[model samples]
Target: MDRIKIKSVTTLAEHWGALRQADVEYRAADGSLHHLKREIYDRGNAAAIALFDPARQTVLLVRQARFPALLNGDPAFMLEVCAGMLDGDDPFTCAHKEALEETGHAPRNVRKICNIYPSPGAVQEKVALFVGEYDAQTRQAQGGGLAHEGEDIELVELPLDEALGMIESGELTDAKTIILLQHLALERGA
Candidate 1:
């Protein structure tokens, strides 16, 4: 096995917003030196949560139009989980808000499951995952998605098994959602 040693990392260009460019030098294990240049898109960070109503035997999800996925021809834009960018706020707070907005369901119980990097190649975004347990009866239909932010989300209620099946069948391609749902399934011994 060969390892690459990072000699140094330098920021080449930076914007006022969340994306930038960088350059780095590394020493190959075989004693060769190399330079790598790439753009760094800093999304600040984000969080996602799986909201489940055990009493109702249902899970909350959202269907939103994803331009990239649409371009890729995935008609099933439906996804499982509540997710959003941190936006300079606490990850837990952001996750809670995203859950309520995306599903119109306020969670009574929430737990942090994991934090992950969905794509480390270009986007410098880290997603913190959560599992929220709530009473479906108390949910409201308040139209919680943010259209100004380019979100036209449709709330969805699905059976646990069906949601899991979607994961297996590749209907759910969001990485953070997958991580949370997989953890939920494992916790329930499903």
Candidate 2:
């Protein structure tokens, strides 16, 4: 932990998230020193949750636009679990808030699925993942996400099997979504 010494950091951009480059001297395992420059996108952390219905073997998901995907030659619209930036709220609170905003169901039975860094090389953000149980009686609102935040979310409820198949079929590509789905699949022994 004390092997790396930071020399300086330069900000490249400062918008929704910060893009900065850090110069550092790293001490190798054999005691050799190496200089390195690393660029990181600091968007803060986020939380995502997969809402599942055990009785129906179904999961609640969302579809929305992702400009970054489009820019990277992938599908602009992504099918994913409900998620959002913490914005100062705790991970669990953020997950619940996103669930209510994007899926209409405030899950009562929620469990952590561990935190993950999908792009450790460039992104300085960690996501706290979760899975929650829901049912027909749990509908709190007609969720389509907040229009004011430019979020045009579409609710998609599909059988767990079908959702898992989407991963193999290349329809589900979001890392957080895939991780949560695979976790749920393993829990169900599917």
Candidate 3:
């Protein structure tokens, strides 16, 4: 299908000093007039990276408290890859920094896997996904996370097979994490 033509956009409200409620008019493929009410978030785009150590047969995942997951009835804390919002930095650089801060791992070979829009319907957050194969020996810190940001992440090293099992059992709930795992399991055959 071709792109829809945006006829007009009007701001209706703003919330959290960041979210914007807007009304938009557009012409669909069939030339029908339609209006959409959307909640837009002016969030800076972000990136996430999955790190694997083939020799160790392990993947480094971060465990953190997520309010949404907690409220969604997930008893187990999330097991996710390193991720953070971009801040006037390149995707790879930001991902590398996130990995260090969140998992205490310095990524050696970061490769872009894909870019995705987490919530195109309402939010303007975009995620640049990456995969990295890193040396697992440098274990400088235990990855208590960046304390100043109130981040209390614990880096968990799981065997690739166990991580894949977590994915199949719906234990890993984070979308970007799941995407990375799926890519590894299917495309890379890792």
Candidate 4:
């Protein structure tokens, strides 16, 4: 705390997430002071999970439209692990709820993997990552996400090996999804 000082914070946007610019004063290792302005985006926090079925050696994922990717000329619909903004729920609760809503599968015996800051350079959001086990019995509804919220999610089940291979094939590019997949693969010694 002694090394940095926030001079002021000004809100730049307050829509989906709150974006603010912070004027900061920093003390360097060489005993120099520097002034810097940085923009920070805060959307509270979120949680995500990798849904795996041990019996089938497969994982359940979701595909949905991601405007940001589309805006960058990438495909609009991207394959991703089930996830959502926490709203007011705890990380675990959010992960469970999102999994059920997006894939119609409520994972059992979920184990949290880690918490990650996907873009600490500018985003003040922390995501709790988890691994959950699922099977056919867990699927209860024809989950396509909350259609009223415009979530047109599609469930994608793939063998764990094939899903991991997609990372090398340039198919699955979502970072959270990739991290969860890699973690799952490593945990299973694949």
Model 2: residues >4 Å from true position, as ranges? none
Report the C-alpha lDDT of model 2 over 1-190, residue by residue, as the tens digit: 6999999999999999999999999999999999999999998999999999999999999999999999999999999999999999999999999999998898978999899999998899999999998897888998999999999999999999999999999989999999999999999897
Those runs of model 4 whose alpha carbons end farther than 4 Å from true positions after fitting are none
TM-score of each: 0.85, 0.97, 0.87, 0.97
Tell me the tens digit of each residue's lDDT in model 3 across 1-190: 2444444455555552267666667677787877877767766799999998867767899988887776877765788999988888988999988988887778776899999998798778889999887665645555667888889888788888899899788788788998888887775465
Cα displacement (angstroms), candidate 3, residue 48, comes to: 0.5
As a whole number from 0 to 100, the lDDT of residue 140 in candidate 2 is 95
lDDT of candidates 1 onward, in order: 0.77, 0.94, 0.80, 0.93
**For residues 132-177, could you state the per-residue lDDT of candidate 1 as single tens digits?**
8867465765644876877788877888888888888987888777
Question: Compared with the true structure, what per-residue lDDT tens digits does model 4 show for residues 1-190?
Answer: 9999999999999997899999999999999999999999998999999999988999999999999899999999999999999999999999999999999888898999999999999999999999999998888777889988789998899999999999999999999999999998888897
RMSD of each: 3.2, 1.0, 2.6, 1.0
For model 4, what is the C-alpha lDDT against the true structure?
0.93
**Candidate 3 Cα errors over 4 Å, as ranges:** 1-17, 187-190
In candidate 1, what residue range of length 10 has the lowest lDDT sum? 1-10
